[model samples]
Target chain A: MTHALAAKGPTASRPKPAEFIAFAVLAALLAVAPFALYPFFLATALCFALFASAFNLLVGYAGLLSFGHALFFGGAAYIAAHVAKVWGWPPELTLLAATAFVGLLGLVAGALSIRRQGIYFSMITLALAQMGYFVALQVPFTHGEDGIQGVPRGKLFGLIPLGDDRVMYYFVLVVFLCGLLAIYRIVHSPFGSVLKAIRENEPRAISLGYSVDSYKLAAFGLSAALAGLAGGTKALVTQSATLTDMHWSMSGEVILMVLLGGMGTMTGPVIGAIFVVAIPEVLNRIGGPDFAQWMTVIQGAIFVICVLAFRRGLIGEIAARLRRTL
Target chain B: MIPLLGISTQALFGQLLLGLINGAFYAMLSLGLAVIFGMLNIVNFAHGALYMVGAFAAWFLLTYFHIGYWPALILAPLGVALFGMVIERTMLKRLAGLDHIYGLLLTFGLALIIQGVFQNQFGASGQPYPLPEQLKGGTNLGFMYLPTYRAWAVVFSLCVCLFTWFMIEKTRLGSVLRAATENPELTRAFGINVPRLITLTYGFGVGLAALAGVLAAPIYQVRPLMGADFIIVVFAVVVIGGMGSILGAIGAGFMLGIVEGLTKVFYPQAANIVVFVIMVAVLLVKPTGLFGKKL
Candidate 1:
């Protein structure tokens, strides 16, 4: 693990021009993607990218694997949709309310979850999240099966109305970018260094006088909050919150995204999220309805192959090969 | 209305009995998980899926082979254990040197594959498996009418759990197993085949889950999603109970089950979340879990 930590050092210290160029090109491509592809599909990818990046914050950087992140992501979506649809709040206020509400929920969840380490932590988070899932299922606010649908995407901050699909796409893009930058900043901060230290060697970090538990709790909260951001944004974009958002399968999907892209790399989760979401959609288009059901099988196969064969993931593998050469 | 603490005594007893039955399954599943975790240092995420397979096995036996519950109980576990052994030999064995997370991921993938295939074949609807003739009837227990099979399930699971506890705690083989868990390399150096022990331990753990599955099939509908749904709650029970002690897992499972059942009586809407709430509370007070040792 320490060796893996060292592998990240060179990339952390420098930001090359190529990285900026790549981001610019990706952003340009995304900006134009809505015109070519379905806006809904692009928005879905954006939401997942944010969600996966949020997940990456914990597993990739903090060495914590939470199997229950769907609770935060999907739970917040339900809440935001309910608020926007039922209460008739403007989109901006609904997003804020959803993020704050889910963040608080995450704080509570994180506080409970950080008590155990490693696999126990994963199980605990998963259990708690499942509890949330049941609540979503049975609760009246979720409308049982129908969920809170037809959520009005009102004016953003009482200005710049977001009724059009292209406008909504750009709104989601901005939010996703903000989330990505937040994660990037957090990973580069001194707090993140301590988190990396804890991940590498917990006892050593504890011996160095860092409060490891608190750091872990903080990371968990941040990850949950960001996932909430994604979920809240998604609710607005989709104009609905379904049971699918909070399901355990969704949690697994986010994990797949992070694992496929590159766990610790900043850009990896975004790429992975896009690929995971797009591949299924693309396959659906090509293979038709029967292929839609097989998407899970494909995802499962990908998970097995990725874990068994390419542990480094896309960006991580590239970085490893570059390090060996340089 | 006759009230025992503002509720009918018979109804209370019935709910308690139901709670005990649920606890029985929780105890069995978590117990297997503890055994596997103790020896293998990996949480068997597929325990629930294996449990589901146990139920399906019973369903298959009855439908295809005309085997009754009596034979299926024994056969289902054996079949699952055989499958478990095969899994150990092939995929799980290869993951021995990797991070523990990979074991979880591998089992998760296996679980998805298994559940997905079963769902594709059987669809999401549950298949009904009738109880055996002997255990089909009910027993009048003065206070409430008790279904014989439910009572049998609770008592039988209790016996199995205790028997396993006794095997692990009292027997010489148990000592060797404990020694293996403590220091596998040292035990291996002493000519004990630790790897083989690991495989057997996994098999036994999975068998325990299968046994629970068989027990549950007659009660809950034999469904593909049944195991997946209950496993998360079991994970919570495992956390609340603490993974270190076998007795703790059993005690916590039953305790939480009763609490959940009681919650259903008083506040029906909260029945599903009561166990999870208890888990959160337990985690807050004792992060190491009630019986877990700090690593």
Candidate 2:
């Protein structure tokens, strides 16, 4: 296990000029995506894109396969929805509040879980997330199974109304881009290098006088905050926050997106999220009544195929072939 | 109806019995997981799915071939074990010596496929498996009325768990299995067929899960998602116990089940999350798990 992990080395490499071009092209495509597609669908996909990026930050960059990340993602959604519907906060404030709360939640969860490594880490995080799910289920504000429904999109920054689908779509896109950019910068920064070092060889990092646990916890918190931002934005777009977001399966879905996108690559998560989010929507549109079943089976097949043959993921493979870092 | 801590003795004892039954399943499932993890170095995420398949196989046997519970108990696990061995041969074999997470992901995918297919076929509702004729009635044990099937399940699962522990810890083959787990290469150099050993171990572990499923079918509603719901809690049990020792898994399984049962009696709202809470506490205090050796 140690050798296999160390062999992965650091995929986070020095930034090249072509990477900028790819980023710009991605931004331009996303900016015009809503014009061609359904704005609601685009917004949802963008939310998932951000969610997957946040997940990749921990799994890809930090080498932490946190199986319970939905705690922050869905936990933030509930908080965002509650603040929006009950506290009547502005959209920005709601998102900020939820993101902050989940960031702290991540810190605590990370602190407890980082002591264990590998499969133990995954199981601990999963148990904690399942605990969070139970809290969401029993807590009164979540309104039990019905969830906090009809959440007001509210005005952005107290001035710009975001009720319209096109306006909300743009809001989500901006947030997605900012979140993705934040993740990209973090990946390239000195801290990200340290994280990669820790991932590659924890004992060696410790020998080098690095506080590996602190670094891991910091990365976990940051990843969690970004996931919360995505979740908060999703609540506003969808106009509800449900238990589905916090479910363990939601955690699995996010992991799937990151894996499908190419775990360590900058553009992979977004591409992966789009595939995952869009596949079900498309299936629902075209398939018969049993499509939901097929959707799960197909998702499972993708997981198996990705692990078996496409471990580098879509972007990772392309980058390898092109001999360039994506 | 003697009052104990402001609750009826009957209710308390009844919940305790239910907890014991839940603990029985947890013990069996986690025991299988520990054995497999020791041998495979891969967490079989498909465990719960295979357990569900075991129950379904029993259902199919009864519905199609008019087989009874006793035969299903023996045959279902055997069938599932064969399926598992084949999976190990064709799929899991390719992943040997790679990162363990890939095994987890692949098995997770298998689980989703199995669960999704069954759900599509059976819908979300549960199919009831009748209790065997002899185990239908209840015995009044003074404090509470105990269902005969539940008692049998607890006793039977405990026996199975202990027998597995005995097989892996006391027998000569068990020593070889442990040696392989400790160092596969060294054991292989000793002229043991380690790969075949691994395949059989996986099959045996999966068969244990199927046995649990058969035990649970009569008590629970035998729903498609039954294992899914139970697996997370069992994961909590594994974490709490640390999966290092077979006894730890069994002990923690029953203990947590009783704790959850007691919580239900005292504070019904917390019944669901209590095990998870204990898991967090355990992780915080002893990250290596109570019985786990230091990493």
Candidate 3:
């Protein structure tokens, strides 16, 4: 048990040169991924990858398992879509506006949810997000069950038009890369160490004079904002923002990605996201529509298997083999 | 036909009765959750799914085998308890001594699989459950008319909750259960079969949930997704009441249900979120919940 917790915890080692090279290689691959794969699919995967990474920041580092991240991800999508379609905001501005709104929402939610510790924290987040879903269902702007749709892929910065699919894909990639870099910065910062300290032993951190709740709230807010970025990017990519984004199932999907890739490792969530997004699409292509119905069951099975046997996850296992923090 | 705050007394009382029925469900489900959490140290996320399964089980007994409600009321919970014990013995046993979060994740996975399979088989729509012959009529009081089944459900669930509380707080088996919960290692040292006791406690809690589901089948439609949304509200109720005391859970459940019903009558717009709003308010003032002891 101790080993399992230790394995999932963050390493305090400095970033090695090989890790930097691997990161550069990954970025280059992503840069060229659009040429080999469908840009739309790649773009969608990137959005989810970002979402998983943002989620990883909380669950992996801070050791706070929030079950309602869908509120931020899906809520931001709604806000971005509404502003782009109704308020005639440009793509970049709309995304920014959405991220900012979700960040504040995160602060409020984090404040209330952090009042309880452990499992209660998870339950509270879930209940709060469900409440948000009901509000979205009743609110006029969200259009209830229909959701906000047909959001324009307006010009980027009012300069480069995103009307073309490739242009929009490139825009998504840029946003995703920037989000990734920001997360990397955050994870490696001194604040990250404090978070890890709290994760390792909260009472010890408190004894050491760190305001643990404040740090947790900050991490939660930042994670929520990054997830918002992913959601906003998704809205622009898909040209729609619907209730599916904010549903509890969506929250479960993100958790699956984080777990599947590897929790607490920077590389795990991205890998997990790619596989999660690709698996469904692959099943749709290979299994026909009838077999597609098994996706939820399959996802559930993965969750069960991961929890029971593969707690280290794909990247975590790989890192264990290489004896280096990925 | 007298109006109270511009609403007829009949409508107000009718909603209040509905609220009480809903409260009975919340009380039962939350009580089950609290019991499971105490024994297992893991919140049972599949609880809602199991409740749904229980409802469907009753429906199956009635539809496929022509078993009536009275028999199903006893049989369904027993079947669910057996199923729960198997899961506890097999899957949950492996997760002992780990962080509480993994149990939640595993059960969550189980919930998804259960809900998904049922959805695939039944689709998303609700199936109607008929009231038994004994519970087919209504009784008119001075203020409002109350359906017999609804009143029975409220009274029966209230009795169950109280009986559970009494058993846990007063009986010898309950004392053993409490001792195991407080100190499993020490209890095991005393030659008590702690693990088996834990298993039975889990079964008891799950059986309670199934019993609630059986009661709910006739009151609400026996739907695949019925437990999904209902469970979240119960969680809020749990948060408000705290999982420390069983009676606290029951009281909170009934109080919040009435509060929700009152919202429907007074301000319809906030009825859906009133429980959640109350949760946030409770959290702000009392972080440990109303009856919760600091862990």
Candidate 4:
């Protein structure tokens, strides 16, 4: 709550009552979504939505495009899965530990990557993440090829068992809401303004006495921590952490979600995440991996079209049209 | 531990030769990358895919039209270069004046489409392209048994790399290209056709990748994923070489390939990752790359 109040967003205005009401409506909708939809799918999409939302905070709000977010998301998933399965840690402890570890990882990765700007920066992050992917494959604790399977969901706290699917979904939902709201507050906060200033013009920001690199690093660490949060929650929900999670392709998928949903908008990435995840799933239900291969072509086409034609994205364009933040 | 010191001179030299062959491809691909970047200011992310396309083009020509390796070598690159031209004029040209990242993203998408379509049509398992009859044999050297094709590949690619260097660095036409690359608007004012030069440069760079692909087809099994595997290493090579210097890109490619080969000999597990490790280290010391000018 403090972070949210602090971030008030890129704008430094008073807390508008409408913003609170809109967030409440969004929460109510997501809370009731599982009853109308598949609880398992909702749980899965929530993980990705959180991932994309966190990614948006960096790319959309902070003006840094990280092409290697899978380093955080998949890395944390593996760590959380390992701890839950082997160490028998409770859900909260595993999530906290995994997220914190990735935050540290992000700090190191971000520090090195911020040395380069623009395209070079993206490549640096990508190369480092690729290294992390190899680590996931070669490391013993990750179990190499098979990944850490049969991860125990464990209890939410000390008392409430989260073994039931419905209970687990609700737990995931609560975590998702916290992560989303935190991002919102971060974007609206004073720090977010500094980040925006850096994004808009770094030299000017530097001239104004802002430590641009430190701000960028802070934003990266925050983004990576939130991505870790999503990934850790996912491991608990799925009871597995496989290598595909860390693949460069998964990184691309998150970028796609952010681009499709609208980079800077509040709700764009979540909507985009749901769309990408859901479409593939619906196709999987009808056909197999062959059908999914076609999805790659479609995705590629979307990327080309989006860059050529629709840069604003669905939610972003809508928000612009309505003259109100979604 | 197995006696690392006891590894034979024959074994070491053999790996070195293999490394040189890999370096030949690396040199050719990175040279293409550097040239394209020089002209376009956009890294051609689909370069590896084009290389794969070149190999496939060769395969298709041989199977359907009875076009053998020698003829396919010349023809396949030409065909792929034409395709690259179309991509530039229609797609990549639109990305001009935008952030370099947009160009990167656009080409990345094209690569996915191309690789995906090929993978869909032909399974991921490799397809063998046999050595042409003349190049089928090998000669036993005191140091190593040099396959006729392997020696030819190393010498041939080195010549091509050098020739490309001469064309870009030495020739009168190259001076024009250099001028255009330096300042397009100024070059245009000097009565040069900058737009046409940009298009041709992209095609030529892509053709170089295809040429390497044709050279690689018989050596590495022609697979849909052949380029995907090497492209990352090439990116590492690019990062180390720095994008600004053509000579640097080629030099780094062969140099890193040897380094990778030596790593395989010393610490086999580290071979796959050694290039990336070096990249990080280089970045720490010289983020601008070894031969790179100030950005």
Candidate 5:
């Protein structure tokens, strides 16, 4: 509850017309962006954006810093990939199945973790996620270090085939938008308000007669679902779901995305996700034993600097200066 | 030699011994965690990295300086403690009045940095540490063969854990530490140099992790990832033990270790996740943990 996440929770009541127009413009830009941007790169960025937005719901809004979200993201990706590649499930079916599985995963994780407060809560989620990672590493279906690869994009609902890169890009784009809107609605909903209240002052919210744990659990569930949606879509986009997706480092990356974008702000995670995803790729372009190798080090430096100097992140800082929620 | 289930007595004892050794590591690491949390109110997410540093210190001492295991045990922890104190003085102390999560984040960041640096310097494939002459070979127990180094690990860590417990729970110095934990301002009122004490306490806790690391070097490959691997399990151990009670941390660590060992013998698939499953069950039944007094 320090820095931007602690600042006036959900100050804006709703997504304004301007904000709606802004989103429409952004969506439009994204749609026409294949000529300007790499489809795979854009798809990856969108997937992470969705992941970060989901993360922001708990962290930015509810003040729950879950360090093990990879359970949903990577775990769902694994499920989606396995179903799609082996079982030959349709894209829609795989997405739905993955989302459902991860949502259930989230509920159990949230239920266990929400019992503790503060640092203990973070640690529990992390430990559980790490256990999930162990399962991924050891379990037969996950293929251990090899991961599930060359997964077919397949047909969405057995109708629209998503074999082409453009079609896959739009599929990812739509999923990202839908997930983003769902998060926006959740954050602005009365339920979202309660989450904010719990986040702001748990004791006060409890005294006010709200079933705080349920609200927290519900938030956790929704967050995990959206994160699942992103991950499942990512498997389709990348045509693979590697162990990298579920690693604790990926969880750390998602946190960085949320922190970098502006934890509570709608656009923050999206902007942050894109920025973070691009940095390593940019460094890799300058590949050597020196510069590219420094990516992880730089990423670690970003975490330290963000916590120490700028917790509000880029969009957060902008919003702070403008005296408005970004 | 009693075999409870269909599992052989020999196998059971071996797993139990292995579990005991793991529990020893858990107890020592959790003790460090509990100490830091009680005094500094910081979760010290960098703990695993610090442990990694300790193991690497041993590796470096032997690889370059030709320092033997005995001296590395003393010197490695001392160096790590000093580094930890520097961390406390510069970075963590700045976040005194802020939310504790900042401390968690800052330390997590430090963990990433430390781990990243280690990974960069030493590739992910672990460097092996040779066994010291003093702790090599094995003794044949009535039930199972026990490696001397593993036996030493369990015994040495238990002694350290108990010594730490004694110092913090039984002595006048322990009372002062307790007073500071309760109310730093009140303790500072008595001219006790509370800030310095806080720094030293963090150092001591970090030293505990380093000590565990040094012990583990001969057992496991000295790798950058070793601490990260163990730290999460230790965190689960801490959660079950309850953060407030030192004895609880020590006891729970050992118990869970045995539980894990038994699980490995019976249900191997569930071994890695058993502690976490237990943590979830504990939270469901008692969120305050086994011995936790506070919410």
Candidate 6:
């Protein structure tokens, strides 16, 4: 058992230079893409990619599926928006406040949810997030349906003016890259190997003297913090936060993003996030207003097909085929 | 002079009655989930959608076929069970050897389809299902007035929940189910048809949800989105009760409902979230849940 566990550890801890190079190329493309594609659209995709990658950290690597991650993402957005708009904090400080607040919330939620495994864990997280939704709906500070609107983007470190859409797009790209790197580092860390051990066999890990619950809770917090990073950035870019962000459907959309990309693969979630977010926009441009709501139908179809036919996901399948050829 | 720190007796009784009514649906739905999970080891995420279908089925029967409430109650669950059987046979059967998450995903997809189609046909707005004339009136207790239909719903659901509990905990067939839940292969070797039992178990669970939906139609309007949020709340209830015990589920449901009602009386803002709060507290205190066996 120890031999088997030890063998699994090195693979997770070693980071491939190829993966980092691929990310760098992807980052370069994204950084330059606003010149060709719409900057706002590019920003939106970056925000969602960050969110999906954070979500992927939990579901893909640790094997703990949280269906309520929108709470962290959207809840932190509300916090960051409120702090920036009301407290007049610098953009960086507000982002920090939001990330910390979300990380704490994730700790509490993760600690509670890790008590149950599999579907029960998913349900508990979802229910707790719904609870957060109810609180947001009734709370006075959220501004009810309108949310905190016209949130000032404020200066990055009170220096670089993010007022320009192009500048803001670059700012969002940088944040997304930073968050993605953090996720990649976590997934390849020694702690990450322990998490994978717990995921593969909780009982054995527990029996082997590892504190399984703590590892799971840590992973959850890391995932939530990264999700908060995305949400906080998005709130700044969009200049508002609303109830829609905290909704369960948002949670479902994130799951779809991760599933479509490839769970456990570094490149898969980024690709998944781009496709899931951009597809609806593309469809709207082509099909017009009447077909906008059809996005849900399309998303639903993708989720079904992914689960039924392509469980390994886009990147995982490609990697497997390449390996077979090699 | 009225007592301090005491609500009027009438108001208290009324809230308690309302609590019992909400608890009835909770008991029925959670029981169905427990049964399905026990036998099939799969959580039916579509349980709520199936329940919504039951309410919609009843509405369709009334509007389209001119069927009354009694006939609709019987037909709605039967229709849902038939639908569940079809799902088990076609889609769910394919997922037998996969991880439990795949089963959940499949059901979730089915739920979206069912809810989406219904949403397309009937907009988000709710349609009223008239209370049957026989059950339209109220019974005047000295402390509070109880609507006859609400009373019947509570009593009838309690009976159904207990009947199910007894069947699973006491009967020979239930013993086989319990045995199968522990060791499907061993039970199969003993000549039990495990796969058929799984389909029927799913059907039974779906049927229970449909029955609850029929019961709920008169209280809550028949709406496409009705089951969506309720399912999430029921999930909290299941977590709090520790899905391992049927009696625990029923008890926790009524207990949490009363707590929720009390929250409404004191702090209405927290009522919607009180059950979740309790769930968190339960997790902190006893992670395995009050009656749940250790994982």
Docking class of 2: high
Which candidate has the top score in DockQ? 2
Which tens-of-lDDT digit does each residue in B1-295 have in candidate 4?
2234788666777688778888888889988988888888888878989999999999999989999999998999999999999999999999889877778778877887888888888879888898999998899776567789988988999999999889988999999999998999999999999999999999999999999999999988899878875777888788788878878888898898888888888788888888889988988999888887766
Q: Between 4 and 5, whose TM-score is larger? A: 4
Candidate 1 per-residue lDDT, tens place, A177-278, comes to: 888878877887667887888889999998876678888988988999999999999999999999999999999999999999988877788889999998
Whichever of 1 and 2 has more lDDT, that candidate is 2
TM-score of each: 0.95, 0.97, 0.97, 0.95, 0.95, 0.95
- List where candidate 4 sits over 4 angstroms from the true fold: A1-22, A285-289, B1-4
Model 3 alpha-carbon drift over 4 Å, by segment: A1-13
Winner on lDDT between 3 and 5 is 3
Candidate 5, residue A309: how far the Cα is off, in Å: 0.3
Q: Which residue pairs in model 3 clash with each other?
A: none
Q: Could you report the DockQ of all the candidates, in the order they appear?
A: 0.66, 0.82, 0.80, 0.63, 0.69, 0.63
Model 5 chain B worst lDDT run, 10 consecutive residues: B1-10
Which residue ranges in model 6 land beyond 4 Å of their true spot? A1-12, A324-326, B1-6
Is candidate 3 or 6 superior in TM-score? 3
lDDT (0-100) at residue B113 of candidate 2? 87
Best by lDDT: 3
* Tens-digit per-residue lDDT, B1-295, candidate 2: 7899899999999899889989988998999899899999888899999999999999999999999999999999999999999999999888988877788889989998899898888989999998999889999988889899999998999999899889989999999999999999999999999999999999998998999999989888888898886888888898889888999899999998899889989999999999988888887788888887765
Model 4 chain B weakest 10-residue run by lDDT: B1-10
For model 6, which pairs clash? none
- lDDT tens readout by residue for model 4, A1-326: 33653554345545446456667887889899988988988999999999999999999988888878999999999989999999999999999999999999999999988887877777778778888888788888999889989998988777899888889899999899999889988887778878888888889988877678888999999999999999999999999999889987788889889888888877889889999899888887789877977877777777787777777788888878877777
**Candidate 1 lDDT (Cα, 0 to 1):** 0.87
Decoy 1 TM-score against native: 0.95
